[model samples]
Target: MSIVQRFSKIFFYLALFPAVIVLCAWQGWAWWSWATAPPAPKSSTGETSDADKTVQIRIPPGSTSKQIGSYLESAGLIRSSNAWDLWVRWLNTQNKGVFKAGTYELSPTQSLKEIAEQISQGSVVQISFTIPEGRNLKQMAAYFESQGFFPAQDFLAATKQIPRDKFPWLPSGLPHLEGFLYPDTYQIASGGITPKAVIDIMLKRFEQVALPMYQKNPQQIKLNLLQWVTLASIVEKEAVIPAERPRIAGVFTQRLQKGMKLEADPTVEYGLNIQQTVDQPLTFKQVKTPSPYNTYLNRGLPPTPIASPGKASLQATLNPEKTDYLFFVARYDGTHVFSRTLAEHQAAVAAIRKQRVQQNQGAIPQPN
Candidate 1:
């Protein structure tokens, strides 16, 4: 009797235990679903999701989460400002405040989680600008304005204030920073860098690249920083062909040594009215005109450089091509013909003039 009673009691307890386990599992599943479920359709604020359009938002420096949320809502990046704020705050609490300040690009289709991640990662707007070599401060300022980097007046004024002493390679007391702004494409924020800051960065880069080259040359050939820069500037303006730069430099150096007139066309062009084009053929009158910058009339280098030079021109000036050539004239083709003797130079000039006359005569319309 005792064995049967014990067996029945044990069987009853085992069945009861299974029922209790199933009930607990069901309750736990319900709790899990409630806790891990997606957010409600409408947040605490009365707002609906409009996930159809994309928008860009600028979260400026020192902006709070609430301010950023309002900006996002105003930009149409999200439908609910309050919902975005709450989500961002939740992230701040969870991730220990890792969000960064920037102008963020967001789409309405993005979930709060995705937008939050992008903002925290400092995703922002960017722009590209190109500063071409040999551009004067005025020209560079115009370029900055055209690219929306800064206002023209602001840049111009800032450029005027840049201390010439900061760049010893530039002639002292010049009107503005010249021959120091290195030219290259730069990625910058829209309206982010100050004009002075931009100029300073470029000049720094120029010094970094050019200083070593200046240091290595012999003292006679190695001019002081300013003279080297001047020579480089002349070399830059003299030849459009990369291969011709060293040869052009050689001719200038020869003239400098012999106390001869440089007679460089670029210097003549610089002396002419601003309307003159670099590519236009020079008239004999233009060459003979007396100006402070006219290398033909003057025996030494010009008062100042005509343009900013690039690395290649700088290098060519430092290490010129060794040749006996003292005169060079542009040939019928794009290249130049060099000569060592005055007679040879005269003959070359005559040949070039004859070719031009023949070409012009051939192009003239004959009477019917």
Candidate 2:
């Protein structure tokens, strides 16, 4: 209790004050961590229900770690992009969260670790339905029905009710959703895939496939989305040879620029709605059909696409071969003879008719 002893004791308490404060702060932090830390992710049997929260998130090809993390975050499958990035860096996962790009079935309840592993594996299971090129919406619908998938009527209804507001690139006053359903193989990623979702998927794929071209040079293609797809559908229906797509695209492009009637036979056939095709010559009356879809009667491109053009046809329409040839007549052998002059086109048509006559004769040979 002497002055020297009291002063020494005060100095000792002051020295210990900072340590006491540090210990108290550490203890508080530990209590908060224990109180607020996320519970351990419950194990799932990997079975997905038809919950609205669960969705198929597509990790675009070649997406960086940050890009993928952002997508998952937006989809509500991850907490946040920054958290995902930090976690991925900590795990040093396969490619460090630069996951394999594909459509993945994801749920909010899944642990970040489980999601990362599934994506790194890159397994897109389920069925893939291939929509072939040059098939009209009705034909496409029929194919869907034939496969015992969605009913044809339901498929058609979805096409009729495309959420165009969701797709800004899709122009207004489209003839119908005929040509926009991009022709490709799409996997049914989930058990709850509905008809409307299927339509959205096709258009989304089209956007993924074609939006970059338009975005790169919006003015390069002189037509809007509807017009471009319309012309491409015609070219898709006309071009039989794989190599002839560009040439066909060129023919349509030049004709559109010159203000000439397309004179495309497919347009006339579509106008007539004649389903039974028996490899016979069209009657002269069929050429003069009075329908909006008939390019022969109408002066410009059809109001809507006649069929779904494949990616090649769409690309060809956007970037044509840029030729002077204005006309083409289909030969019997899935090829066409190109011509710039009317007389040349007529001669090509005549040659095809003669070839067909010879083929018919050969089929019915005279017994000698």
Candidate 3:
């Protein structure tokens, strides 16, 4: 070993040692900083508006950790995919929770660990929507479309293919799920927001809330399930005021008992796919139009329920207000004028028409 050769080798070894230490230190610092730093940093005003805003990210089933990390990085939820990989490796060593597939509401302000924990625990976001009472299938379909849930016709088609296997109590040969879909606010995981899923959930809710009402049959209304729902649907459309629901149901019941025509305008509108606006009402020709749903022409309940009635309307139909009144007319103020005879009904109709004419400069109203 010559002195020059040995010294040169020692120097080379010393230089390499410092370089390795500096490189290791730089890598460690980078790992720590990335683990702690948020994707969206705070502004000079100390407000993290962008960081606070949540983004919806869906993790498909069977995605690997690498794929998930890349997804998070692309979504701007994580500072770096490499840092996420390191964190995942550490988590794997600890045998922590497994990542589950779902729709997540993630924010940029969340740390890598926080986001990872949320996804691992399957903390999925749930989306909710409300179906107001008196909305028929077509209206409901349009509503679903407006909310970007599904196409309108898609929902309409789903309604036709009734899920009878799961719900055996549904009346056989139902043309469509018009009256049975109980209306209410429903919350479901975002990943499961499909047409069939919505319909099944709504049907299940109907089974839970309304089916029992008929099963108990406290009032023992002679009407079958289909008949009860049909009558309640009529009451729902005609009676705007909550208090008038029972009275309206009573009128329908009396007319049914006497075998007279129901003469409900809503039925004609439903059949014709038209709405009776304040300026334009059902015409004489429209009323005389032959349709199965035209209660003005048909002598019984409509073929199917015109709309989905609420629990209150269903209860009102079952235990209607016992009255001798056989007819009623809407005053356009969420109130009705009840009549027991043809003359009284005609007079009340005349009074409403006269009031409309006075309000609108002698404009005549369409005949009932």
Candidate 4:
């Protein structure tokens, strides 16, 4: 009964140890699991859209899973704190710095699974706003203000407050955010969507999108990053057709290299400070109105970006197409006609004017 019985008993307990631990874990999860049943159909109010029914809850910085769960329970989003705790441990979203700390939009109507996934991913409630290419910072400020996202004055002020040291991608010596806003559709959390927050996120997004190309070959970018963005901003306004960006970029590059005037129409328009903006066109005299921003009068890129340049325009400036073309004329159909020589450019200009004249003329009908 000694050796054989003892060894058999030891093996039985050892095998049972794992199973017991597994059982304990299962029980612990069950204890923490949300006990609430599915939400009823009519829980939302008539005034609130289904999307608007979510209650805003903030997870304070450095909050533990247990603490987060307690907060959720207090907010009445979950059945109990322990239930939320259990769900967090099960999902492993709160594991080893994976926990996301931010204000979250959650509803009691949502399943524990959905809440866990949402918070783990740090998905916050966001209001979307799009920045169109070639829009200057001032224009952007007014647009955001009109949308009630933030005050235009506050937005402009926040641009100067951004910590340049934190972001290597952003060029220093710029007076304002200007070209770096990186025109794109952005979503921000409803309540905390500050102008500073928008600028921060967009700067990061710009870094993410543009840095790769620069990192590949910094020398390929002929101009400094800030200057390149400035030039790209001008190109953004010039090229309406997406296919023409690289070529338009090429024409600008050629002009720059030859020490010839850029003579870009947008630069002059920007310089004139047109109150109505692009809605109003500049007269011929405004093009000759000398200003630092006016490429027709200036030797190089503007002191800063004239407007926000999109990715296509940015890339175009970074790697301008190799071409001899130095001039371009806008056509009536929102396209450009590129010309390599002065004579050729003059011909294109005359053709464009004739087309516009034809477009403006009213056809005469013979009397019946």
Best by TM-score: 3
lDDT of 4 by residue, 157-191 (tens): 98877568879567766678888887889878764
What residue pairs are clashing in model 4? Answer: 32-83
Q: Residue 93's C-alpha lDDT in candidate 1?
A: 82
lDDT of 3 by residue, 1-368 (tens): 99999999999999999999999999999878976577876566766576688999989889999999999999999988999888888898897658988789998888888899999888899989999999999999999999988899999998899788999989999989999888999998876778899989999998999888887856635888899999999999988899999889988888898899999999999989888986798999999998999999999999899999999999999889999999888887879999999999999999999898788874557678
The collision pairs in model 1 are none
Clashes of each: 0, 0, 0, 1
RMSD of each: 10.6, 13.3, 4.6, 11.5
Question: Any runs in candidate 4 off by more than 4 Å, and if so which?
Answer: 1-124, 218-221, 275-280, 363-368
Q: Give candidate 3's TM-score.
A: 0.84
Alpha-carbon deviation at 33 in model 3, angstroms: 5.1
**What's the candidate order when arranged by decreasing lDDT?**
3, 2, 4, 1
Ranking by TM-score: 3, 1, 4, 2
Cα shift from native, residue 356, model 4 (Å)? 1.1
* Structural similarity to truth (TM-score) of each candidate: 0.69, 0.64, 0.84, 0.67
Which candidate model has the greater TM-score, 3 or 4? 3
> TM-score of the candidate numbered 1?
0.69
* lDDT of candidate 1 at residue 324, scale 0 to 100: 80
Q: How close is candidate 2 to the true structure, as a TM-score?
A: 0.64
In candidate 3, which residue ranges exceed 4 Å CA deviation? 1-29, 32-37, 40-71, 85-103, 362-368
Error of 3 at 54 (Å): 4.0
